[model samples]
Target: MPRAVRSPADFWSGALFAGFGIAFAVAALAYEPGRATRMGPGFFPFALAVVLSLIGLATLVRSWLRAGPPPLGLTSRPMVLVLGAVVAFGAMLHALGLAAALCFVVLVSASASSRFRWPRALLLAGAVSGLSVLVFATALQLPIPVLGRWLGG
Candidate 1:
């Protein structure tokens, strides 16, 4: 008889990784990969897909070799808060602009952690927002405004 999977976490993660890798690899075929000397837009994605597939294969093999506890169930609190943070960022980006959106996302997501504190959350939000503005706005010169129409930019 065939051996069953001993680790649910490994088996599920491997399947998910393999699925994503195959999907990305197939999608990459539509674009030109170019040569190794001068890679095209598709080359990096294709290479990454191959690496992901290999990791998945290793994990799948490990699932059969070693016994492990069953995967823990997902919690709604963290999931909801994190997803909310992403949505908040998207919703606020155009209206409040990048800095505010980044700060909002950080604060909301930080609330999901058990060790969350207001002072720490605010500090982290400020640091990340400032760094993001420095990198994407000042340094990279992305066209996104620091403040939007809602904030009288």
Candidate 2:
């Protein structure tokens, strides 16, 4: 059906994204040389910022091609859950540690799905969190904190 089309909202977001990228890229220019050749801590951020700015420019171009006013849709439930989990994860990172935090992240993320169930949530959360902890802490030596002082280092 050649039915309906919704106009895109303000291109300001693209501009903002581009602005953030520019800021990061500028900051990265000051990065000091590290062990691996010349690139240091700021290298990735600077590169990412440039990429973000390009994306923003592309989005702005796309927006300019659109015809008229746009309708932006926002949903409450999923937004609340995802944002809440992210905030909680940030807050709990020190105390709860990676394993616990990953569990929370996994379960909360899974719960965002309409098809999510308790059993699946539990299984997936445990498996994903466990594997993440093992790989990061053991294999990669990422210094991921474990839940308790006794259990982790």
Candidate 3:
């Protein structure tokens, strides 16, 4: 008889990482990667892909050697909420601008957790929005408006 799967989590995680790593590596090849001392646009991504692939391979091998609990069933609520938050952020970004988009994303995503609380979610949203503004607007001076034209910018 065939051997039973030992560690489903490790196996699945490894497969996912390896798949992403390979995809990234292939995509990075389209750009020119310079030598390590003189990095090019593709250099960092290619290097990271190599490291990720190695880690995934190690994880896959380990799954066969170790015993672990069976993989948990997928839940739709958290997945839907988190994905919806990302889509909402993208859709609202141009109209509402970065700060509002960040707040929406944070609050919506926070609700995905079973332990979500209004106070905590609001606090987290405020912190993330402030930090994003500080980084992207004040520090980086990105051209993105703090408030969009729709908000009387």
Candidate 4:
């Protein structure tokens, strides 16, 4: 294996993913078992951990085969900006409602394009938010928050 100081970023990322995957898998094992007859609280988390571990291992293997793993492949500015938006979006939900959360997710996710416009964005965000509120939270009964209880509207 040629280790002539190739891209260090790949090695690090692979290591990090590996660590996270292993940690999640280990955590799954520690979850409490079913109480009486049905699956317990640990069921979902445990299943998710297994999938994560498999993906992490595959990533590590591929990176090893590829020449110096590409860096985290994220730009510094976009990363920071997106992270800030995510935090702000979550914070807004507490003050707003399910409508706000749906809007935030849609708007923030759509913002990756340079051609995004406020008017179009708002229209699309509002439509999607309204549909989500009506369908999943109401028709499907997904137990989502509404603007009424908090906003008294």
lDDT (Cα, tens digit) per residue for candidate 3, span 7-83: 88888888888888999999999888987789899999998998898888887887888988767968999999999
Candidate 2 residue-wise lDDT, 1-153, digit = tens: 012322355365666777888888888878863555766787677778889999887766656666446546677778888888988888787777888888898888778889999998999999988898888887999865777454454
Deviating ranges (above 4 Å) for candidate 4:
1-4, 14-69, 81-86, 148-150
User: Which TM-score value belongs to model 2?
Assistant: 0.55
Query: In angstroms, how far off is 49's CA in candidate 1?
Result: 21
| Candidate rank order under lDDT | 1, 3, 2, 4
The positional error of residue 103 in candidate 1, measured at the CA in angstroms, is 0.9
lDDT of 4 by residue, 42-147 (tens): 7777777777767766656665666664466667666655676678767766567788777886787667667778889889999998998889888999865666
For candidate 3, give the lDDT.
0.88
Off by over 4 Å in 3: 1-71
Clashing pairs in 2: none
Question: Which pairs of residues collide in candidate 4?
Answer: none
> What clash pairs does model 3 have?
none
Give the better candidate number (1 or 4) by TM-score: 1
State the weakest 10-residue window (summed lDDT) of model 4.
1-10
